[model samples]
Target chain A: MRSVVIAFIAGTLFGLGLTISRMIDPAKVLGFLDVAGEWDASLALVMVAALVVMSLAYRLAAGRSAPFFAEKFQVPTRRDITSRLVGGAALFGIGWGLVGLCPGPAISGLGLGLPQLAQFVLAMLAGMAIHRFWFLRKGSH
Target chain B: MHNFTPYSALIGGALIGLAAALMLLLSGRIAGVSGIVGSLLRPAWGDWGWRLAFVAGLVVAPLLVQWATDKPVSINIDSNLAVLVSAGLLVGFGTSLGSGCTSGHGVCGISRLSPRSILATVVFMAAGAATVYVMRHVVG
Candidate 1:
């Protein structure tokens, strides 16, 4: 119960942050990505500031054996720089550049009652399903 | 740039970071939206509850904010259906293949100094810039 409450509050904060930062606006995202055009360097600060805070959080977590409401801190342990990572990131970037939306922003955007965003979300789910069925099930990892 | 907003950007970013911080310190979970949602596809019986709750909060918060503030969440997306679909497909497929997305790898992973996350961030940022350049310059 505590874990669920914390997750919900964290998610709410995240959604609010995305909204206030205008990261949910696809046009703004594209502008940030469009380095050749009138480059909006605003979004870079989002990453920088997020990094700063998360870094501190990581430091705090390092001192503790477990989370307040959970058994252990679930962090990714993979260290290899694999082809799959690079390839998939590149493809994801292409998609991001194409639509100027990511999973977080895109999912949050659904609340605004945008038909186009709904279509994108549906297609995104389909794509995930496809990957799950084809790549994941086939032991592609 | 007319749309440049450093103050809001930083504040919003800090809030996002705080959110991640809460998740890590309280729930011992990474606040990576893509990873969270992806895992739901094959949820362990005991693990899906928080994920669903988190997603519900994410999807509902904006509505609550709009109601409270009378300021709807601002959003502008591509009008073309086909392009939107294609972009969505690529995003979903790629994020799955990569094992993370912006929040996962970009914010959480990079902050922890994960080599893979750093490399992934660089690759995706470069790819995004290059794609934008190509679409606006070469194609347009």
Candidate 2:
């Protein structure tokens, strides 16, 4: 099978998982984030389950010489803790807190044909484009 | 909270983990939604196809879910248009600058035991919690 096909299947599974778990719901995520308010602790269960499976699976994959379909695993190797990382996460957190929608859920929200989701996605794309343009101009990326 | 869904969350999360694991095993990709989307923004040679397919899959998954389970895809937006736009821009810029989001840093990176990802997750979660605190408590 082709990598694109595999990627699509993986994405489908991911989206389905999010939907079934109601992770697609912003209010639920906000509830999870809201420790001070009426907090919903169910999202933590999701994280724990996912983490357990992923950690075990990753350890197995890490030992393999190569992936079944691809030549090598392209894992993140950068280990630096730059200000950009912290600052970017802070901004992302603020946006998430405000709307309870992160990139994954936001993209999945596109399937619903809601104008509001479109608005959020377009603004997000513009933000990404602006950052890309700045980096290109500086020739630093 | 009106809806409590621990069983769904656990099953859903296990499914997500399986998906990520399959991506690693079969395609050598990190199954990070933001990272995949970000790469498509500035595509290298021969890097556009899989990313496009992945995004297409994302866009299609809800329809399939709706069909299979009779569950309408739902969201809550108490914020106005201006607030939504601002939040979108902030999330985009922040994810780009931070180099990952919940999937990349929180799930995949943490699973692999990366120090940078651990630090990133801690910072983002703390900040997210604080912001939520202020938004629900202090401001409103």
Best by lDDT: 1
Q: Identify the CAPRI category of the predicted complex in candidate 2.
A: medium
lDDT of 2 at B26: 86
Q: What tens-digit string does per-residue lDDT give for candidate 2 at A102-125? A: 888889879898777888888888
The number of residue pairs in model 2 that clash at the backbone is 0
Tens digits of per-residue lDDT, candidate 1, B1-140, equal 87799998999899899999999989889999988888888747798888988888788868877999987677876449888899889999999888889999999999999999999999888988898898889997
Model 1: per-residue Cα lDDT over A14-48, one tens digit each: 98888888898888899999998999988899988
Model 2, B44-63: lDDT tens per residue?
A: 95988888887877778888
Worst 10-residue lDDT window for candidate 2 chain B reads B71-80
Question: What lDDT does each candidate get?
Answer: 0.88, 0.85
Please report the candidate that would top TM-score against the real structure. 1
| Model 2 clashing residue pairs (backbone) | none
Q: Which ranges in model 1 have alpha carbons more than 4 Å from their true place?
A: none
* Winning candidate number (DockQ): 1
